[model samples]
Target: MEAITPFLNANQQISVDIKTLREAPDFKAGEVDIDIRNVTPLFLNQEEINAHYLTTYKFRLYASQAYVEEKGIPQSIHDLDAHTLISFTKDGLFPHTYEPQAIKCKQHLIIDCPLAIANAVENNVGIGPLLPHIARLSQQSLVPILHNQLRQSLNIYYTYPASLTQNRMVQDFYNYLQSLPEDFLKGRTHLLAKRPQKINPLSDF
Candidate 1:
């Protein structure tokens, strides 16, 4: 929200609400002019709501250096059984293709917020999946586990009522959002340039 504040004119005012993407309130009643969400709500009326695909984000399993040194690195899906797992309290908007495999590991903790989960993993609580951008932002030196194997992707969207599409303030905000640098939206790979050396998958240890 802070990123686009400069674009608003003197007559324009803005209100921001942060909540789960699925719980985004209806904008048809004119309560909101724009609703930015990570996932498109299922109940959104296609005729009434206009959603613009913003960008795609990828997630990978991460483990703290402390945890890796203590439990040894997991090289295969079955190896996860020997390590503790951290997960969200609710299944998130991302796809669950890798969930079944994750369930096989012993769950060490469940967190409601993604940031909190990353913090716990960083504190050496357990290994868990998180967005690479977020992990890097935390500045905790987390090792990417199964980097070539397990992964999930999500697309962010900017949605607004069809009626508000022509509103000057709304359009200006939309334009600013669209103009964001690609690296800012998708994150930079150089953030992970110093990532620890990859673990050998076939090592017996």
Candidate 2:
């Protein structure tokens, strides 16, 4: 919505649907014009769908200022025992390498929507994992927690029917989305391996 909202006129309308797709969609049927999803091995094994890489995201733990003030900061994964954990449903769907770790929380707030999870965390619900860009939208109310020790990754992909390749508007919109993430992709790790970093204290809330 952030990307498409700017250019809309007053009378225009737009809709977005979020789902965990079980199979490659029949885009030729015209139920929807475009699809965006996190790349998975299932997406790789299918020949019917063509997934275009958009950008990679690092999912790091965050706590709102209000949360930290009440429960104190968690500097390690072990520290999370006392805290509530906010997470998404369908946690086991992705391969470990392509997705983030699914934690076992003492107190869990499980929701399917990423935006909703961010809002819950922002409202001082619990510590949750979110991409930095999403957390930045929190206006610094969310503070990074145990960032060096625990993290997850997601690779976003854009898809459409191979049939749309030559259509001008679809092509242009896809091209625009492709270009939008150039700056966001910097320093993001799509790689499964990386050098280790030194641990630090969680001081700032």
Candidate 3:
């Protein structure tokens, strides 16, 4: 909702498909119009597609206060091995390098989407990596843990078919996205941050 609400309200007769693409979509076949992915494809053929540097997404470990109280805060990264950890399937740190195996997460869950990961954390399912902005989606506040230790910075790319570079709609939306600040995408500019937070109940039922 955060990324497309404005565009949806401003435009009409447009369809958008948002997902994590493991392989390049057949843009020419109209399989997809635009793709915003955190990891740049290792074999992005510059000759066929255009990849523009988007923004860097910083992910930190987050766990609901309830989860912390139940499982206890992981004092060290290794401590995560003893607790439930949620993460994307591959858990790639960067575009150039992907995780060779499911080693990052030592426990039950391999969510394929970041939004789902946030939901899992909000429900006190497990500690997982999430962008700061997505943290606000939770009804209850989620605390950042090992902020200094468990942090991931991945660069996102704005990709489209080289042939459609001149298309008005594509250019218009891309320009609008670039006009927004990096903080806006990362949750630094959210209303929840500015508003006074409601007090959490003192007792956990």
Local accuracy of candidate 1 as per-residue lDDT tens digits, 77-169: 678888877765434322333244434655556664667778888899888878887778767788988878777776666666676556555
Candidate 1 global CA lDDT score: 0.59
Q: lDDT by residue for model 2 over 1-205, one digit each (tens)? A: 3444442232133222333443444555643445555656776556655567777667777889999999999877778879988766435311233344555557877775566778888889888877777788676578888878877677766665566555454455456657665544332111111112211100000
C-alpha RMSD of candidate 2: 12.5
Which lDDT values do the candidates have, in the order given? Answer: 0.59, 0.58, 0.63
lDDT of 3 by residue, 103-140 (tens): 45456677765677788889999887887877866688
Error of 2 at 65 (Å): 1.7
RMSD of 3: 11.3
| Whole-structure CA lDDT of model 2 | 0.58
Report the C-alpha displacement of residue 126, candidate 2, in angstroms.
Answer: 1.1
- What TM-score does structure 1 among the candidates reach? 0.73
TM-score of 3: 0.73
Query: In candidate 3, which residue ranges exceed 4 Å CA deviation?
Result: 8-22, 90-97, 100-106, 181-205
Residue 58, candidate 2: alpha-carbon lDDT: 70
Question: What local lDDT does model 1 show for residue 63?
Answer: 90
TM-score of every candidate relative to the true structure: 0.73, 0.69, 0.73
